[model samples]
Target: MKVDWSPLKHELGEWRAAGLTLPLWWRDDDAVAPTESLARLESLSATSGVPVHMAVIPRDATRSLADDLSDQFIPVVHGWAHVNNQTEGKKAEFGMGRDAHAARLDLQQSMARMRDLFGARLAPMFVPPWNRFDAALLPTLAEFGIDALSTYLPRQTATPIAGVTQINTHIDPIFWRGTRGLVPPDDLVAQTVALLQARRTGMQDNAEPLGYLTHHLVHDADIWEFSQQFMQEMCDGPVRLYRHDTKGFS
Candidate 1:
């Protein structure tokens, strides 16, 4: 699983020469409680100096999790229940086949629960389960006090709605459809290079942070090791860290 990484290093070098910085961030989803894997993840983040946005499912989230979180972590809402209400398609908590009124109720309740559990620790961001959500629900996010939306792939628009911004992850190390192990490191590195190159050339939104996504609860040893190495390498390059307050880019 050794990756060449030369292409990415070279591209980063170009950015350094131009005095430009690559905005970088990390997000890990489906956290409801503390576990050994989460402890390891926190350790890795401490070592790499990259803060992790822990996407917590509100219905299952506990106050103990909020207490355990350090300054290096940001807790964001991960959907109402993480339940797949769809009958015959990709699993989704906020997708089609669900009644809009019911969905809004779920969201409202989730917001209340999360606020009670996490208090001021919660970031006003919503991450739909399975990276799938109904587009029709975008306008309603601000009504529930959500300020941002996160999903897979590059974001199509920075602000899907006036008050809510969108920022998405581009690189996921796990091969979910396969072994769910770390994807071939070489392939992952190549994809990272291409994604950065697109931004450098203005083919994509350069303002958006290059995001790395993970699911710590399911990480095998190989995935954990790969994540550590990949994150360390990214930090070694000309990368600027992104915080929730990062303006304009969301």
Candidate 2:
């Protein structure tokens, strides 16, 4: 499906005319091992000049995967095992059904493993699998030395849990509930336009960087193409590439 990016393009043009810059970031979740998918993701990042915050599942992630990552990649922790314990509800690795203490321990272990593997390249951010987590776990993040938390939707508050700052992805190209392929291009573009409009009009926090989320392992060709095109177009406009060390709370 051909995407009509006119709405987003017009909004970006307005920002450009006003000399406004949108801090733009990309995140790709559920990475464990090195594969051709990861290589393709790196190639896309190199071409578009957008670095990906690669969310690595610590329990299954190997140090070998770290070798495939370039300086353009920032490794962030993505839950311990990426396992969903919720028996009857929506999937979540850190949901209320599980003991919070045990979950915290998992997080601590993951942090240590990630630090050992990625070292200074680790962003110290926690991205829960499936973007689902129990709110009771938020206060415990700072105690575990986690500096940032990433999830879905625009962040409701920048510092939602005092020391732990929140950054979230606003645009996701996948239609997980349906085709598991790319969402209709027109719908994605329109949603992106609406998100930007809300920020521009003070309906959303403009200070929050606009985030694009992907799963490199699951992307179809259409998803890959859209990602490259969308990111490149934004780069050509008034978007400023966001880096992990400089932009977020971490």
Candidate 3:
């Protein structure tokens, strides 16, 4: 399908005219091992000059994954096991109704395991499975050395608690509840334009970098093509890409 990217391009032009550059970043979740899909992701990141902050599930993560890391990949913790602990409601590895102590232990283990695997390469970021975590656990993140928390949608506050910074993914190309394929490209572009408009008009926090979320393992051909095209457009546009170590966070 032919996609109209002019809306996004026009929105970005407005940002440039205001002497502001949109801050953007990419995050790919559920990476556990090296695969062809991951190789493509790495290649795209390298080519686009946009580093991918990969959310690796600590429990199922393998040494091969650690070994396969390239300079374009930033590793972060993605819950303990990616398993659902809740008896009802949405699937979450660290959601409400679970014992707080157990959840803390899982987080602790997540940090320890990922640290051991990724070592100095790991960014101190926590991404709860299904992007759902008990809000009560926010304050305890610092105890496990986690300084950043990422989830979906616009974050209400920059710092959810005292020390941890909250950055969130704004655009997801997948139509999860329906086809499990790419959401219509026109819809995606519309969503992007709307998000940019909100930020530009101060309806949302403009300081928080816009995050592009992906699931490499699940991406079909259309998704991959869209991702590549989107990344290229953003990189070529009037935008600044963010990294965990960048002053944008400091």
Candidate 4:
């Protein structure tokens, strides 16, 4: 029998129905300003009882914060350098913004740097800048050992890599482009609520976790303040959080 889905009830049904394993990642792109963002990530990891993911630039050729994650958070390479390539006809894409030749080169360099330093701790996932990447750059991910990519909604139809996994997001905490920083509490709540709704009513396509992306540099102070609370609310409400591997996506 098809289970009747509500908010928490629907999510719970999927968990058992599809044997779903939900993985929630905590993102803070561009490590330029590290103090407040890292602090909040650390606390959230400790309190959340789940592993939090940090995407670091490490272009400084340093691993200060990655070495000091306190075992609660996991570190992944955000990018070699968080530079802008919006002028290339897109506003937020990094490597994908480059031409085919340049994009592949950047991917190779990033993978080498990541493996040389982070090794096993390094995830084979790339979260592009601005949550934007061209579909054409998809194949380059596999060439660089990036077997998985976390992007925004409307995933690529043609899978780029032979055995790669695609984890794209639909919800974001901050109201970027509109308010930049200092996002209103109501907006953040609304965004989370939409994700919560998507989690139910069989809206989400698969058992993938309700993906939410964030940019610490652009996120408002109020976001850091309420992120944990919002997460708690979702967990208490209807969403079940698990790792990508748990859901067989990693």
Q: What's the ranking of the predictions by TM-score, best on top?
A: 3, 1, 2, 4
Native-referenced Cα lDDT, model 3: 0.90
Candidate number with greatest lDDT: 3
The model with the greater lDDT, 1 or 4, is: 1
Residue 150 error for model 3, in Å?
0.4
TM-score of 4: 0.77
lDDT of 1 by residue, 139-205 (tens): 7789988998999999899999899988889999999999988898888989999998888888999
Model 4 residue 187 CA deviation (Å) reads 3.6
lDDT of 3 by residue, 125-158 (tens): 8999899988899877888889999999999999
lDDT of each: 0.87, 0.87, 0.90, 0.59
Top candidate, metric TM-score: 3
Off by over 4 Å in 2: 246-250
Off by over 4 Å in 1: 245-250
Query: What would the TM-scores of all predictions be?
Result: 0.95, 0.95, 0.97, 0.77
The digit string of per-residue lDDT tens for model 4 on 58-158 reads 56546655555555545555655767766656565463446677666766787787676667777677877666676677667776667667767735432
RMSD of 1: 1.8
